[model samples]
Target: MKQRPFARLRAPRSLAAMATAGVMALALTACGGTTKDSASNSGSGDAGSGASASANPNAPIKEGLKIAFLPKQINNPYSTIVDKSGIDAAKEYKGEAKEVGPSDASASSQVSYINTLIQQRQDAILVAANDPNAVCGPLKQARSRGIKVIAYDSDTNPDCRDIFINQASSEEVGRSQVKLLSELMDGKGEFAVLSATANATNQNTWIKFMQEELKKPEYSGMKLVKIAYGDDDDQKSFQQTQGLLQAYPNLKGIIAPTTVGIAAAARYISGSKYKGKVVVTGLGTPNQMRQFIKDGTVTKFQLWNPKDLGYLSSYAAAALASGQITGAQGETLKAGRLGERTIGANGEIVLGPPFTFEKSNIDEFDF
Candidate 1:
């Protein structure tokens, strides 16, 4: 039996349920080639051209509209919180919404789900893509049929989606993690990044910034030793955490930018001899990391509210569907309780800064 909250933190995940859905998706996608080569960078496949659409800020939010959330994988704790909140937001706006995706974060697994969404004629498709380019073909087909594509949390390529609802700016999220680790390790030592999928757009983008941030004289004492991928699976992440420790005995810190990886790493460190010796910090849900903080496995970790991220994305999807604004730079739209947001260059809409959770304030948050 399963309980509420983050994936891999509570009871066994309902991976069996999601796998059944993913099989049908794969069947459908197999016909469409299900690979990055299925679509070319040339014009026809680069849909998400909302710039050509007109804006109407005064347009009333439509009712009974169908929107679907396609996460990197629905069987993830962080992604579950995000998609569930997005579904709830759709209800608030009088629209119908649901979440659908593969159980695994494999590169091509999400494409078939995108095809299903397109066939169902969803008014909007919100995706946190596994690979930025793998889903472009289906997304292009979706946009050609007048469906609004909004990339959230993890983005697709700019040409593949209309609006990207970023949890935080890529540079800030990446550089901040390095800065936090520097503070913990006193700016010196060897660390590694336990990431999700290697091709994960957001993960790679953030890691790039983290690498760049390290080049500055302020972080000369710190060296990034290795980057290990757990593919967003809890068991694999736990193993990767152990492997990292074995591979680098002098590793002073571990930065796991994915929620699954962070929780898994903290779980491993808490029960091992490395407890307290290796600092674990990165983007993680407060609920999942609460015990780690209390048990002294981790001193601090950071994340923007995933619920707020989904809520904001739902509204952004609705705004595009309702024609409130096109995905143009400087276009503005209401985001329910988050107030209004303006679209930035490249259709990016940032949620804001990350919040650090520590012993002092970790108990204040539930999810």
Candidate 2:
């Protein structure tokens, strides 16, 4: 139950807001709108700032507890898989859940949806934040109104959520990318990271570690010249990859730590003159990267199972709603099928570690 000194959750702090969403107030009429009865929200009491921060292992997951999944982008393949898994997991505990979000992965796009969820009075709202500060105010309002906020995949500002369901240790995810790229590039070359949104919490945290890792003497030969943001768009990321290659003709590698960015980078490199000359590696799904591996466009890449990330997050939401844990260090969470997991400092529950995929074994699994 002791907190590990190896890692500390990023301290809660205010940063400049990325953008603000216009707020609209609406009143729901049962005749044309959803009410509490119709929506099936059925949990309470421990969601406010004043709720008791204690764990009760025997508490039952409340029946009809309403939870919602708000991914960075509803249409994104990676977010789609993660959110669907959360929805299915909610059903296992008799909790009602629905997915809602903007089609674009933008900082302000998700704000209106969070406000809608608040108006609907859902029991919990699970989010994969696009920008930590942009969504902070709305999340605070949700929590103030007694809605449990659980952030998964990408985190919000630390103070905005009840607990964070981290897919893997942030530092490990970052350093691993540099390590993978080093081995692929023979520990010496010019490399640049093709990351997600510029304001993305998870992506930035991992990038920080990657920069730190590069300071090691073993990696003295490699240089990180730039960090480009794709905003998680397919076309833009493809263009970004092309631009990176043309701009840095001598660049030997690209690390894209986002699923969309990685796949897009691979797609561009596969058909271009850089196919065999540049090494592309980062986090991605097997289905998305399998073809690239087969064609030798990418020698190696890494990712944790996104489905497992969702399932674990859903169960953790259930635990918080059921009053089993209170987002405190040393508290234990019981995730169905995945078994029990302990909470660490700053209410973080890391799903596990990342896995590397290569030609010889890429065909063995699918997500």
Candidate 2 on 1-367: residue-level lDDT in tens? 2122121111113211111122211232223234234223322333443145557878989999888888887768788777777777888999988788887888899898888888787888899999998998988777766678999999998888889999999999999889889989999889999999999999999999999999999999999999999999999999999999989989999999999999999999999988899999999988889899998999888887677788889998888877888788888978886788998998899988777778866775555
lDDT of each: 0.84, 0.82
Write out the backbone clash pairs for model 2: none
Score candidate 2 by lDDT.
0.82
Query: Which parts of model 2 have CA positions greater than 4 angstroms off?
Result: 1-51
- How far residue 139's Cα lies from its native spot in candidate 2, in Å, is 0.6
User: Where is model 1 more than 4 Å wrong at Cα?
Assistant: 1-49
Q: Candidate 1 residues 60-90, lDDT tens each?
A: 9999989988888766888878887788788
TM-score: model 2 vs. ground truth: 0.88
